[model samples]
Target: MALDDIRARIRAAEAAAGRPPGSVTLIAVSKLQPADRVEAALDQGQRVFGENYVQEAQRKWPAWRARWPEVALHMIGPLQSNKARAAVELFDAIHGVDRASLARRLARVAQETGLAPQVFVQVNTGAEPQKAGVLPAEADALIQECRQLGLNLAGCMCIPPDDADPRPHFQLLRETATRNGLSGLSMGMSADFETAIAEGATHVRVGSAIFGARPTERPG
Candidate 1:
């Protein structure tokens, strides 16, 4: 199955990059995938998953979590400040913390609930207006803000422009994380995970490759 194949590739990539095996975590992106498929991955011993929508996850994950209590779910999509508390309660890690407002909200929620998820500030390496990430130049300040707010900031994440080479973007994210004393690099998707691993990615979010493509119309 693709889950096993992806893990094997990760191990091989780690060896080629002279990194220790199990250094990188493969987040099986379960967003928009069917329950049966996600359960199949659980049966295959995949304990880490990534989701994009808070409501979708809220609707599905609690039931799934009851069965797979050890699963770690990551929020890998744009997070709204309005959903901060829910996100804090649901995710083990959040990879889309990109703004001050969202960070502040997350901080407040954490303070109220005493539950904070590991966070990765999303950096807009391409400076794409439509993208939901902090500008590359401002990522430092955002990281600092998150830290000051008492959020558990683990690292930096980026989604390179689809049309351009992702290696440079990956390198940029790695450098940002390194300068901030962060160790996690949550870049790379199915197409360029190997390159991301070479560039020091500690977590790679692979969806379609593992779960098959998401349905065109998500079920209500």
Candidate 2:
């Protein structure tokens, strides 16, 4: 039921955006999900998945790769500078690059690894104090700095405040990308992906809609 709903939403969003459904990449966020669930989704034709923690991703990705070599993994969490090497080594894309220093580190790691994983700048559109992203106003400068460091800036990403309408945030991100001459906007999620699509999001990270409710975290 959830998977069907997700497919329906994707279809509707693409139609509303006047884009071919294939143009928007649906990244199934499988941060807390186990490999079996990921394999099931793979069987259902989901080729892209996102993980949050580097350690968790490092543990889960290899098994998934062993079973399905074509699966693409994206890192969609706050990446620490110390974790840059492992992140560059493991994931196919990094979506939480918010600072120039981190971008430089990632670029260096990518260069050393000889694998240029796609990179996205995460912007704190809502300016939440606890979030891990650059303030929206600083995004352009960060992008330029990243380009100077040889990081392939594919697009921008944002997570709007939970209660606010996400359309404005999505619109802002789209405008930011356009102003900077970038093409990708990796905004939106299960709740607000339609708004993101309408506002020109090229990628949407969906979790519960595709993977069911996330499993409860065990006490650390």
Candidate 3:
């Protein structure tokens, strides 16, 4: 019922944003949620998913996909260069590529494994000192660098400052993607996804709003 309700909300957001009927990808963030809930979503036809940790995803999704092979898993959290190979192996998309070094690592691993995942370069639109993204100004260069490394550049992703009005940040990410000839903009979360859709977000990562709060910050 919650999944259906969320989908309805997303469709309404799409309509309100003047986007096409299926312009947005609704990635149910399953991190910190249990595997049973994930299966529930899968039964509800939610194939695209987002997870924060490689090990936690590794622990849960493989067996599920064996049964439901069409699932598309996305890595939507901070990525370590050391985990590039695993990310490439497991994720269908990586939405947290924030630096050139990590890009290079992923490129090399993908070339070696021949399993390159779709990549989204994260931009710190608000220039927040504590966030894990390339500054907005540096996004162009990093995107170009990612292209140079031969990554499958799907588009740009950003996490706007939670306390600020996220619409401007979403617009900036959309413009950055367009200027760079990219088609995807992965912005927004549970709170402002409707506004993000209005500003042209192609992907929205929603976790707690759908699955409810996690008992712990990290997966057990």
Q: Among these predicted structures, which one has the highest lDDT? A: 1
lDDT at 113, model 1 = 97
Worst 10 residues of 3 by lDDT: 211-220
Residue 175 local lDDT, model 1: 91
Name the best candidate (by TM-score): 1
Give the per-residue lDDT digits (tens) of candidate 2, residues 60-137.
Answer: 778768878899899999999999999988888999999988998998888888988899999999999999899988
- How well is each residue in 1-220 modelled by candidate 3, as lDDT tens digits? 2788778888998999777888999999999887778788899999999999999999998899999999999999999998888999999999999988999899999999999799999999999999999998999999999989889999999999978989889989989999999999999898988888888889999888788877686865
Model 2: how far residue 68 lies from native, Å: 0.9
lDDT of 2: 0.88
The model with the greater lDDT, 1 or 2, is 1
Mark the regions of model 3 whose C-alpha exceeds 4 Å error after superposition. Answer: none
Can you write out model 1's per-residue Cα lDDT over 1-220, one digit (the tens) per residue? Answer: 4999999999999999999999999999999898899999999999999999899999999998999899999999999899989999999999999999999999999999999899999999999999999999999999999999999999999999999999999999999999999999999899999999999999999999998988876545
What order do you get sorting by TM-score, best first? 1, 3, 2
Rank the candidate models, highest lDDT first: 1, 3, 2
